[model samples]
Target chain A: MSNQDQNLAATVNTTQGSYRVIVGRDVIDDLGTELQKTGLKGRAFLVVDEVMFPNPSRRAQEALERGGYETHVLALEIGEANKNLETVQIVYDWLADLLADRSDIVVAMGGGVTGDLVGFAAATWLRGVAVVHVPTSLAAMVDSSIGGKTGVNIPKGKNLLGAFHQPKLVLQDVGHLKSLPAREMSAGWAEAVKHGFILDAQLLDTFERLAPQMKALAGEEPVAAIRRSVAIKGEIVSADEFETGDHRVLLNYGHTIGHAIEKVSGYGTYLHGEAVAIGMMAAAGIAERLGMIDEELVDRQRRVLENYDLPVRASGLDVDALIEATKSDKKSRGGTIRWVLLEGPGKATTRRDVPEEVVREAVLAILD
Target chain B: MSNQDQNLAATVNTTQGSYRVIVGRDVIDDLGTELQKTGLKGRAFLVVDEVMFPNPSRRAQEALERGGYETHVLALEIGEANKNLETVQIVYDWLADLLADRSDIVVAMGGGVTGDLVGFAAATWLRGVAVVHVPTSLAAMVDSSIGGKTGVNIPKGKNLLGAFHQPKLVLQDVGHLKSLPAREMSAGWAEAVKHGFILDAQLLDTFERLAPQMKALAGEEPVAAIRRSVAIKGEIVSADEFETGDHRVLLNYGHTIGHAIEKVSGYGTYLHGEAVAIGMMAAAGIAERLGMIDEELVDRQRRVLENYDLPVRASGLDVDALIEATKSDKKSRGGTIRWVLLEGPGKATTRRDVPEEVVREAVLAILD
Candidate 1:
């Protein structure tokens, strides 16, 4: 009957079965209110990263308890390197011992790494239990927390061990971004920019206009920006929930090169989105060199990324190492490198037969 | 077309992803001939147990290669103890490093452990490649191989870590049973008896009539017996692929207590089906005592199992220890033990609300 309840009902209806990507300023403040709607009985397990728990974990626990739900917080070690089988086993064992059940929910409250590790643990524990994600970082807000691609990093590659287990809800409180480090904030913007480049030209234009304010946003615009980016991701995923089509693969436009960079640089060295920014530039160069896109268009795209202070090149990295890393990427099939090439702004396509020479040329050009 | 091709087509339909369940004497001799029908290209990754590989690995691999398919034999340490994350990771990495592609198929050529480990490897490698199962033991062919429930064991519980990955084809070569030790053969029969108790009174009647011959031919069975067992399992799994209902859980009639026994006995000490044999007797006693099933029916079931020399009593095992291990079972949800209890022959139900005291009393009775 109330205005707030009406909006909640609409969002809940749209997000049924598929995860809801709730983007708004100060959404963290509504954690208690929103979780009450899930109607799950018993205590909640709040699995938070050690880095975020001192501030946000307590707040979340307090909110859940206030909403008449019992809460227990489990703080985990942070970083991509910690995402492995050993950690997953430890978490599963802990939950098993704790007797956590389907009636209880796991709140994965951290960045992408934490959400992935926790979400996967939730998926596998007791066959499966409900998991709600409150992604605090930008990369997680727009991308990782929404798609339900949950897994840990194997020694061979990132997400080499995982499953397609969607979350119950994704609470993207852009207010959390106010506390995020500038570099991390910029990394998140790269993904938002990626959504714009891949599907919506108008989103790109709007992002360009508000790019400066996004960097300086206390709250309002960043929340709106995240909402738009999440909607784009949700629509694409809803169309092709599994990565069985080109539309889904197009979302990986900058990721092929980005994952290669992340692998070569060591997972935590550059931050995922930063590596992706540089990778996107490399992709643009590859497309232009192959006569798929105009050289001027490549420059225009670089300028937009530069405005956000995201990386556009890898200055000292070895091109050969990047090439080798790209070969082992999870996306590659039967030894062929699959690259997502830009046709123009707001358009991308997967090119599986892109010659190795073209990939090498693109790497070298980006290095220069 | 050759008579064999026409017979194969008539027996099995490939359109519904349905394949034959070869269940007769000398079935292993037909493995090479059967695999030819799958039209699989490239080499076969022959995964066998260390024990079985010594004798049958050479023959199996030779047969595959002789039929014009390359064969790469991989022998794993035998038993459930070896099924863990380390083994899964090693197998997956080996497959990736070996460049096994979609065209290639993995042959899980051992017992339940091999089927599970290799099946999981196939499911996760390159986001799933094809797998063919060559279950050497009765325990594997009669139950494990047909269900498509592939996964490795964890320290906390058996099959705590796994996936619901089905095999491309299951080669139930009855000839492999010739090599099974008497104890192992009896262990395998426990599951067939379980199928009888859970859903098929006709299977129970068949077992009663053929008990002597089935025991005498511990290493050999008439094609009819094997076919009946496989058909029962296949029909159950087809109805409930993910065990979301009573149809699939009924297949685990004796597994709840069986898993506990396996865990308490430290996995390899007792074969999986052996544990299930004891678990089944315990469950039957519980059902009888609860007045859910008639005592005469329990006696008849005991007579059939005893004829095969299967364990009916939980002797020399600490009751408290067994109870503690059962609490850690994967079947336990929210700390409540879910038991698949039988009301009568061919009737089973999962009861979550059964008191622990009742379970303890039945275990004690079985021990006596």
Candidate 2:
């Protein structure tokens, strides 16, 4: 691990808008200065996940206040179940009580749930207001925090209600992950690893090389992995902010199946990346069977996932139930499910022509 | 009443996104042709206001189906009270039941409530889907429909939840206004007349010239008024789609007090335009006191509003209550209320420097 002093920044420029992602060790120490640069003119409301308040959230509040910002911290109990319109109203009430205006800022600090919840509030408050994200978890840092996708879930589905609101900035403090549990850290790696499979071969190589010490995320390896993953995501989002083109869909390499798994097992049963890890294994299985990739590549993917202690299969799951779940996925156009398949490491393709029988076989094979 | 058989179209090119506003007599007759031109693929879901189904909505559905679209009409009972997340969910259920894809289109046909409701659903469903609007009332055609501002109300306020999802197109059929009650049609004119007060002197002249027959709305004059108003809104939105600058704030010429009036009077007591009419009067009074404009101009504004039968004052409202309402307005910057005051007809300015004592006097004068 490098533990270098300098910060790494990735700027995403899109037709919709543009912003930057900054990742570094102890980068959060500069939170106040960085927020001042976003052109936010009024008071700051720090919406933080309750559990993170002791260290990350409190530090953020102190830094923002130190920078001459009148700050208010709203601590929320966080979980998948709490990510809905009800929770958003609580934040709205806080803003209303403060008479927060368009010039004021909402700084979301926590994991994916907190960002999505606070981001949605900012998007709708006064039609819209500026929002900045300080992601405390790896899953949020590399994926959810960078895309400017803010939303809350309804009972019908996850992220069923949301808007494409770009954040003013996304601050990823790699040191924050030190407080993360080993299992949670490994689950977050699934997205970074999937980024490797879909966009960067060198990223895949780095993950493979660091597989043995994957849980030791205190140093440079974690930051490097997150930076590279975020850059790949930033580039893709810049090209297709609305997901209108194929480029954005390619980033969903494992989401089609991953989403269904999460839905079938019940949303909170598996961490999002855990589902993606298994989904990637299933997708690789299908790709290998179709000869899109050789058996060696599939073996490597499975080995890398296993080395990180992530799940590669779902036990006792019904293929038919899984198939039913995919139909409801937002990516499925009408009756056809668009699958993002791996042709080889770093080479992914979105195919809508995969036979249903082949899909069923792949799911059945991965059901353990 | 020109009833002349020519189509009028204005193409709105905004930095956020662009779409067209089409107005003509029997334009609903061309519903099928326009939807085809939007380049949308997949089935169409016509989310209509139930009251409009007997005439306008059914007409739109038939036209779309005739144009070779597989259309499903979902009629909803409309009102300000129904504009909430609960109603949005019903629309989502309809889309889910049919497995609506990103390729599928949602056509919102009716007035502002329908447009806001269906548009919000379209904005969030599957993260987003393409939506085209056919506004049946003058308010929808001139204001809400063109802005791409789609939202549902929360208990706290109107339009408290929404997204800036640009429509694929906006179609306004002038003939539909014939079915509207005389009061509703007149109420809608307040917004159009407002455009005249803030941006276009010619538009204000058109309203004054057509004042006698405005309630009748029998011909070319109505379509022309709508066309001009839409164009003005289109132009303003193009320059400031996100409302980040002073240009977009100009469009809120009367909305500050107008929104307060709506809030204090209760949501449904006065139509939106009616509240705006009174709000404009209050703004004009303040402008007169500030010597930004003469007493004669305020009187001219009052006469024009009276000619249209729109209220220029609220007889019994409390000044303190109205002032309190203004503080919570979205335009307010923390404790300071930003009022859009007029220098004269065709000239408006957004000011945050108005003394509280002056605001109280203006409200007191307008209370009866």
Best prediction by lDDT: 2
Please count the clashing residue pairs in each candidate, in the order shown. 0, 1
The window of 10 residues in a row where model 1 chain A has the poorest summed lDDT is A1-10
User: How far in Å is the alpha carbon of B275 misplaced in model 2?
Assistant: 2.5
Q: What is the lDDT, from 0 to 100, of the residue A307 in candidate 2?
A: 86
Off by over 4 Å in 1: A1-17, A29-43, A66-69, A101-104, A126-128, A264-269, A318-325, B1-44, B62-71, B99-105, B123-129, B216-221, B259-270, B317-329, B334-337, B352-361
User: iRMS values in order, in angstroms?
Assistant: 4.2, 2.1
Q: On residues B1-368, what C-alpha lDDT tens digit does candidate 2 reach at each position?
A: 22322454567776555677888887786777777887776688998888887666777888888778999889889778889878888998788777677788899988899998898899877667889999888888888898788878777667777778889888888888888877787778888898998989988998888886666766668667778898899888888887878888887877888888988888778888898888888888888888899998899999999999899989667788899998878777657877888876788888888998888888888898
- Model 2 lDDT per residue over A1-368, tens place: 22323555578886556777889877777777777776666888899998887667887888788778999889999778889888988998888777777788899999988998898899878667889999988889889998778878776667777877789888888888888887788888888898999989999999999876556874677667889899999999988887878898888887878999998898777888999998998899889888899989999999998888899999767788899998878887667888999989889998888898888888887897
The regions of model 2 sitting more than 4 angstroms off are A1-5, A266-269, B1-6, B334-336, B357-361
Query: DockQ for model 2?
Result: 0.51
Which ten residues in a row are the worst by lDDT in model 2 chain B?
B1-10
- Candidate 2 has an lDDT of 0.83
Pairs with backbone N, CA or C atoms under 3 Å apart (clashes), candidate 2: B2-B220
Tens digits of per-residue lDDT, candidate 1, A4-34, equal: 3312211322222644456666566667667
